[model samples]
Target: MTDLPSRVSINEEGPREGFQIEPGPIPTADKVALVDALSATGLRHIQVASFVSPKLVPGWADAEAVVAGFAPREGVAYTALWFNGAGLDRALAFRDRLSVTGSISLSASEAFSRRNLNRDREGNLAAMRKQTAAHLAAGVPVRRLGIMAAFGCNFSGEVTPAQVFTAIEDGLSIAAEAGVALTRLSLADTMGWANPVAVERLVGAVRARWPALELTLHLHDTRGMAVANALAALRMGVASFDATVGGLGGCPFAAHKGAPGNIASEELAMLCEEMGIETGIDLDALIEAGHRAERIVGHPLPSALLRGGSLRAMRARMAA
Candidate 1:
């Protein structure tokens, strides 16, 4: 067995990323219930919603309402995603009232940057810089800077490692210039194009380059490699990951519409538990939450843990 971290951290993004791509709008009350459920499951971080244009994502238009609905737990940290100054403004307005952290996401691939945010690479970087500074100024802790499409892009096909490096450098430079310390840095495989080999290679390079920064992987299971890629990352010392409940989330702007969403949080946690790596998550409660997510989304989710019972339960059943 490869040496692993004593305790792994998982950030549940189901309330935001997972629900963002759903065709039907999830009611604010239901979204709040799902988030509240996740928060109670010993998850330290939960991304509640994104502050984006209602025109672009009608589902999250009730971002404020969702924030208002969920009861805040003392130990759990709530987060909101913002891509630009406008989104930052929305988050800032609620900063005092809500217990929320902030995330600033920028795409590495110029093609995706343009398609997703109507900006080129440089433009997106500039926006990220501005948003990061603004978020800090507003007293919202910008915990993470998400580099989207770091592994590869749907539009551009293969993204070079150097490009990903440059983007991270630029983002770090901006953060330094603004005199803000980032708590985490995330590399997102937005298109699910990363393989296990690629994951090790990229994660190794980044760890070598920036040893101090906390690293997280945001993976998509479009090609059924999300878990494999995650395992590869874990071997390379990436202890933090972003996963959605019931495997619900996908980028609507990506080239492939049928691509799967983020890896299921329950499934990942179960894998960690079975491997003897601690995640501090209640497996049964998490599976129950996954079932709740399925009810809210009104569809069958893609969670192996939800479909196949936990390891112990399955073993007990077989023995019986």
Candidate 2:
């Protein structure tokens, strides 16, 4: 077994993935405010927005404005998701003004590929290769290739390890053919269908296959096992994770309506601190960000840390 990483990194996706599914339109200014608040929490990486269709995902219609609004910090890395050529074009336009990295995302499940992206598995793969090449050619610093529905798909059910493996291999092969090296890969449990066993098995398999690749798990709390699955992956030496503040994210095309969202960033930070893992996040500040997110979303969020205080805070109160 490889040695476990002493410090785990978290990518904050609350502004992009978390807000994409909101029913009501969040003002562009509010979105920027939320991201700025999160930036103050010492989060090094944040997915600020996606360059998708505004008509389709009205919540993120202000992707460009949001990017323009946020103050770029020297240490923090900001990224935007791009699915196709047009999204890539949009991201490239702001490349000079904003220090933005690009993420090329694709799905592993055939049904999900068709449902979410209106393409089959092969078509999605082709698009991914093309988009990746474009980003590479543009000198956009394509940092991550995100594989959604890696564990299990809501439409197809039980996505096999072989399917996930093939997707990763194909992505790598495509990048290698273009002479571009991919450093990070993200496995997303799009519908929260993964358990601890599945997390361990798949994470271990990927680690074995690509020993040098950095792996990040994007898990949902649909079955309340997101944290448990994270623990399992950590045991397998996978250290990075994608988390949303206030746990406010769900796929619009997912089979389950009102499904639970990504693991809350504050909750995950609290868990890591308790486990002696260094996340480099201020838990109190993260909780405050969650509260701000709740106000922006105009609803009670699904974060444990937001609902109940952190363990440290509780212990201090008890001791006093």
Candidate 3:
């Protein structure tokens, strides 16, 4: 394995991304407690919840409540996902304390876009453009504008790199014209179809276009390539990544069964630590958190750390 930059940023999406996929509804109180515990782990940036329609995602019904209940910790920034103007307005109501922001996703393929966003790619972008203007006028920050399904799609197969670039330009163009400071922009592998080579190429292409914009990688372990793809992204200086605690998330439309949420946070932290990268996270604490999350979800997590020890132990000593 190759070494990484000394300092790195890890975004905890356990509360928002993890429970959002579980079969049973996670209680709002438990969600608040989990976010509180995560804050103590020294991870300042935590995606607490999503402000989506309760009917569609019942698990996130208590988003506003959880945001209100979780007290702010020093050095911690809490985030909520807002779909559009109404969602952004709901998030802004709590903007005084929690860091309320959102992600706008546009699939590379039209069919996938309709399946994921209930609209075509251009329609999604057009709606987000109007919302972007509103957010800017209200002085609310749009933490991350994500281009979802950038890598590939479950229904449409491999998404072209050109299409991904177009979405990035579209998102940036609106953010610029609206005078909105983008906290981050991420490429989400909503379908878990990205390989290491694809990740490297896509990330490199994005860096070439918007080198100054902070980039994040959100991957799924559908084909068991999340870790490898993430490592490749790290090699490209893509530091920030979105990972759940126990590998607990699946796209509502990205196929059924356990696809595993981005690489588990514990596993990512372990890899980063061994590679001399500082994630500012407590490895043991993160593992414990993963265990707690596994219990809440009532399923065995798809985490390498939970299954085995450090990678060094997996390899035998070289013959002398």
Best candidate, lDDT-wise? 2
lDDT of 2 by residue, 1-320 (tens): 35556788988999887778888788988999998998998999888998898877788788999999998776888888766678878877778545556566777788888877788867876877777677677877766778889988878889988989878877777777777778999999988889999998898888888888889999989878888888888778788999999887865544567666898888888878988889888888889899998899898888877989888778888999
For 188-251, candidate 3 gives per-residue lDDT tens digits of 8887889999998998887787777888888888778888888898888888888887676765
Local distance difference test, candidate 3: 0.78
Best by TM-score: 2
What TM-score quantifies how close candidate 1 is to the native fold?
0.92
Over 1-320, each residue of candidate 1 has an lDDT whose tens digit, in order, gives 46577689998999898678888778888999998899888898899998889998898899989887888888787878766678777777777545556566767788888877689877876777777767777776766678999988878878877888888877777777877777788999988889989988888888788888889999888777888888888888789999998888765544566556899998889878887889989877888899999899888887777888788667778999
TM-score for candidate 2, residues paired by index: 0.93
Candidates sorted on lDDT, descending: 2, 1, 3
Clashing pairs in 1: none
Error of 3 at 32 (Å): 1.5
**Residue 175 lDDT (model 3):** 73
- TM for every model, in the order presented, reads 0.92, 0.93, 0.90
Q: Candidate 2: RMSD over Cα atoms? A: 2.1
Candidate 3 clash figure, as a count: 0
Clashing pairs in 2: none
| Superposed model 2: Cα runs more than 4 Å off | 1-4, 251-257, 316-320
